[model samples]
Target: MPTAPCLQTILALVPRKRAFAASNCRHASLTGGTTIIQAGQIAWVRSACPAGSGPCIFRVLPLHRDGFSIPVTDTPAGNRGARRGSGGITLDDVARLAGVSAITVSRALNTPERVSPDTREKVRLAVEHTGYVPNLLAGGLASNRSRLVAALVPTIAGPVFLETIEALTDALARRGYQLMLGQSGYGESREDALIDAIVGRRPDGIVLTGIMRSEGGRRRLLASGIPVVETWDLTPTPVDMLVGFSHEQVGEVAARFLMDKGYRRPAVVTGDDHRAIQRRTGFERAFAERGIHGVPVFTVPAPTTLGSGREALRALRLAHPELDVLACSSDVLAHGAIVEAHAEGLSVPRDIAVMGFGDLAFARDAHPAITTVRIDGTGIGRQAAAFIADRAEGRAFGQKVVDIGFSLVERASA
Candidate 1:
């Protein structure tokens, strides 16, 4: 039987009817090959013809006239994660195990604010044993400010931003901030619009996943006077305060690392982002500085996931199997390359050393932990928050640029 490609799956499921035509809908490219639509019509979904065997699905979640929206149900939380029931275990079971009422267990899990410290501690122990995840949306809205901080990542299903996001949420909550998450998915225009809507609702502070912005977006952010922090990428001229290392530096360091490892023929697998472009430029310049010529490159669109990484490896192998090392823009792509290497029966590092950018969870977890340039995304968030908090209190902050350095992490892959 023929396999159902991703494009086919999206095309089949998109609601082509007129009722679902507005662009307020959001799309997130998740890990494990699932795309979540945030309550909108299914606009135009199409698949670009593959240059070779790998297939790609391109969908336009038009926020304006072109793309459509689809209705999205309020997805539940916990281990199930918007999935249907898994009958084996549940919160109620954990509550029973802990000798606490289900309501108390829920209170322990969702809002320890109202519960007694002793009860909260008991529920916590039960949660540890039974693995019960509280439904965040469950229990009617109690407080006026949900303490929710809505962060707009380019994509959550993709993994590059997870560490940063986790750190951000944790840091915010430590200071009594809750998180409401959204994914922009390479949609700058849509992201701009999302920012507008998010700001209108008045989130405590807005954390942008990337630095690049549309002109109108720049203006609105400047005028909003809210504590806005831009992470993941840095700029000399920032909208407010910035906390990120330079992408150009990542590229330069990767090139230098490859050269130090005694590899001459270097190729890059990169996502289409301004920062990634900087890295590529830095890498190329470093290569030229070392008297190496003809740097090979393979480019893919952003929110670089494992799938795209696999495809990039295939393309590079076809064109330059002799290439000594492959540098990827993100860890997701590097992990993909590792998987593809196994599929093709090639040994990593021996056949072609692989290097990825983000030192994400999978970067270390993957077979032959991927060597990468590690950015302190958590540090960025913490510092950004500190700056925002200070600025909000009418305290002065002079330095706009915070250079959180990147370190080259050594592992089996490189």
Candidate 2:
């Protein structure tokens, strides 16, 4: 049996009563002149003091047979050192475990092609054993590239933006980049806070669902010097690159389509969100231009649900019984309206025509297929990704604002 090395100084000091419990030693109490307590690979050695001199001092040290002492540094009380990486395992720990330099560990993990196969394998096994995860933020700081793109949307519960989100995620992934999604809610207040947080992290790019409405939010994004792509809703003055269509145009076109189909007394059931309001404005303006005024509008809270849609149509019918056509902000709302219309024993298109925005999946497969304004969500996502990638890589992209327009798909519901 190998004898334990003599402890010179205390690395960590604990009260006499708590010392054994803290060190998790096998020994019950300090005995004789010296007491050695073995706990796993660590050994605690207690040196007895004079009767009333003081408490016996316990020095903790790792038990090594080869006499090669690993340097131990004193950490703050109750703190187990700074955990900059996963599971308190640092690059140095992995390197030491692999019997290589810290730089070699980094090179093996990051640029594996530069490291020899044997060295890489050694580092891999050591990393696996230690459960070490590289700190991407630290690595990003050195490289000045996080390889991360952040995207902010109103809400995730609604399927209207699903296509755009999916396409954006796929596109970013293909370009060796990851996306961090944030929900801005349906109001500008939440969006401003999210923008501030995202800017502080300094991601490679930002994809905004709509053009920045707040001047402070816009300024922060601009000052951050990050690549930005605004999508879904269009404006002449964007924060940076823009990929969207005019919501106003969508509403105006829908109005014209309804007029062409000989439906007078048109009404709108829209959410109070900014984009939805813009669509309502455009719809009202188009009707007003054709000498038609006061197109009855019923407003619903944002993230409009099927229940809200049912309630909206019922309220509108009660308020304006003569209204012949109803335009909804989303397909979800339109589907609810159709259901409610059926509940009231009204035939769609014969009794009242319904039009929806966002040509969602269920819109085409409904009882009476919905006629809707189809915005190219996939195109918006792909274009936004391209813009971000181009700007991030310092490549020149010509068009800053690309309006991939919307189309009105005529179906049985209209």
Candidate 3:
């Protein structure tokens, strides 16, 4: 005998027909791997039964659509999310456990303001007993505000953005808001997928690490109606508000710092990030303004590590041994460069002056202590939090754009 085909293959074997007569609407139970495609009630129900279990009949609730709907393989939450007998925990389960009505449980959890103190206590205990986590996506319909804020960062590998993140988390928590963090990496493409998920969560506000560069990402943010705060990069036209420094200004200042130190042969060791590149651009432009040309630049993968910084210096040395200044995109990279310089028997500042960005904790601790560009990362975070909270609370800010500005920390390295 031929092997049994999967339900998907079986469904493909059936002929498409329109509007079965009421008598012909015979019930058919579906088991795991069993799927049926029917007109009018175009629901793709999945059996909770273990795979290869025998077929069992199920009665589906009425599904109505005014017109053609895109084929749905999964049921929408609004239709089945509240169904009491689906085995998943529902409001009814909590109510039954708490010896209260379903409405009471909902009121206790979502609108505690309207529920009695004693009833709220009972619902809370029941929820804790059942280990039930409310589906915030469903509960969002009643509350309108999820009381959640989302923060997007390029990477969390290094401490480059730790100050800002810590501040944002604490600030939001103080305002009765929770922070939902998403790492988009250094690539713009990763942001699109993250934005889609964040928008679906219906967060009260969104805090982004850098300004959104992609058109699709910006459009989705604008459509979300959530307050947005773009941090760490300056832009006049933001999705909502901006609290950051000018990467261009940082780069120019980095160049000027090295130049003032009497170092003319400068090279920048940078990660391939949008803001880092902007800083590099500014650095080179400053050089060009002083009739200096072709400043050497080495770019490594973003959220750069010490190893990449070491490799960058070696590569730069091979190309230009006369290169004197190493402008690193991050403190970790700067630390790497300093180590590599010592290994190469080059004296810091005398042979190769190292400069770093972010002014991370380790920057000052390194031997010869790195000179770096310091931005008030925590300040930016606090201000961004304020902007988001105020916007969520329907309060207007005095300024929609904030340029926290950057500082060049003069240390022993340069």
| lDDT (10s digit) by residue, model 2, range 1-414 | 333322222222222223222232222343343354332223334433323323332333322222132212223222444332222557886787678999999999777889999999999977765557888899999989898999999999999999999999999888878899999998888999999999989999999998898999999989999999999888878999999988998899999999999988998999999899999999999999999999998899989999988898899999999989999999999999999999999999899999999999999999899999898899999999999998888899788999899999999999
Kindly list the per-residue Cα lDDT of model 1 for residues 256-328, writing each as its tens digit: 8789889999899988977788999999999999999789889999878789989989999898868889999
Global lDDT of each model? 0.70, 0.80, 0.77
User: Where is model 2 more than 4 Å wrong at Cα?
Assistant: 1-87, 92-130
Ranking by lDDT: 2, 3, 1
- Candidate maximizing lDDT: 2
Lowest lDDT 10-mer window, candidate 1? 4-13
lDDT, candidate 1, residue 227? 71
Q: What is the lDDT of residue 210 in candidate 3?
A: 90
In angstroms, give how far residue 393 of model 3 lies from its true place: 1.9
Evaluated at residue 2, the lDDT of candidate 1 is 26
Task: For each candidate in turn, give its C-alpha RMSD to the true structure in angstroms.
Answer: 20.9, 8.0, 12.7
Residue 102 displacement in candidate 3 (angstroms): 9.3
